[model samples]
Target: MQKFILTAMLLTALMLAGCNDNGTGPKKENQPGEILWVEVPDSIQIPPPGKFHKALVKASVQDPDGLSDVDSVYFYSRKPDGSLANKGLPL
Candidate 1:
């Protein structure tokens, strides 16, 4: 009897799971997830000790309605050491 009641409740929950009130996507609206394009400098006269200079870093390109749109662009470097103790090394 307990198993039957649990099964019925699960089925009811699954049936109601299709109801979405978020208008179909994220609050910002995007056909797909944003993309981040990163580019680093090739040659530098003076490179920072703990920094990898980045020439271009395109972030969060979105498609509002199946159309490509450039949302935000940023230029920065990623640390190879994976130690985020210091976040500012200049790019």
Candidate 2:
């Protein structure tokens, strides 16, 4: 039991020491009127199914430095209608 407890404590300490930074992750440089990433659900499940494309609009101007106004990350989804959807958390 003593050995088991020590092993567990050691494992926990190692895991905690290996902390992962969750700061915006990969850096994204702003661009003028540029669409960064676009994603689709393969197929919508509305009634039967439908084809839809979404643009992960980058709400910012050209700035290699970085962007601060991230209007949204997801643009376009079910129920939101033909309009573009935006679900970005601004920094």
Candidate 3:
């Protein structure tokens, strides 16, 4: 009777060990749960002659987990030389 109880307790311990949540399950990493473009302009007109121009850019962003998970949103102008004009500009 004592051996039977010991075996049952061991089995229960093993079963509970198998159900441990170690945060190593199959999870989607860096996935965008939702994407929204609030104000994506159709065209950006450059000023003629020597003049300065500024455009208004806006967006609505969210994540299923939380907003804290989002590190940053990147926005830059691609140059003709195939390089990022403004790198590490916060949005």
Candidate 4:
């Protein structure tokens, strides 16, 4: 019907109006610096289950600015409730 067509057109217009680029969305520009870590083991086997385990992670970092921009690298682990645990470990 004409009413349904008018409603659809109004909705389409409203959607288009709401979709204006405000530049507040996710950054579209390439970052000046980036860090990429090497592929790690899928899972490490802990022998005694409750034993303390340690791992050495390696990464390759690139920066168009300079390495001085990077202060420190931190690592994090997820807890049982789905939140990050232990703040972060500085590398």
Candidate lDDT scores, in order, read 0.56, 0.52, 0.72, 0.68
Clashes of 1: 0
Winner on TM-score (2 vs 4): 4
Give TM-scores for every candidate, taking all chains together and pairing residue i with residue i.
Answer: 0.26, 0.26, 0.41, 0.43
Candidate 4 local distance difference test against the native = 0.68
lDDT of 1 by residue, 1-91 (tens): 9999999999988877866743665575445535555444543555688877544433444455643454544444445575432376443
Q: What TM-score does candidate 1 get on C-alpha atoms?
A: 0.26
Summed backbone clashes in each candidate are 0, 4, 0, 0
What local lDDT does model 1 show for residue 63? 56
* 1-91: candidate 3 lDDT, tens digit per residue: 9999999999988987888565676776675746676675555677889995687878788897788888767666655677665563533
True-structure RMSD, every candidate: 13.2, 14.4, 7.1, 15.7
- Model 1: residues with Cα > 4 Å off, grouped in runs: 1-33, 36-54, 57-62, 66-76, 85-91
Candidate achieving higher TM-score, 1 or 4: 4
Runs off by more than 4 Å, candidate 3:
1-33, 48-51, 76-91
Q: Which clashing pairs does model 1 show? A: none
Alpha carbon deviation, residue 51, candidate 2 (Å): 23
Q: Is candidate 2 or candidate 3 better by TM-score?
A: 3
Q: Given candidate 2, what's the lDDT at residue 10?
A: 100
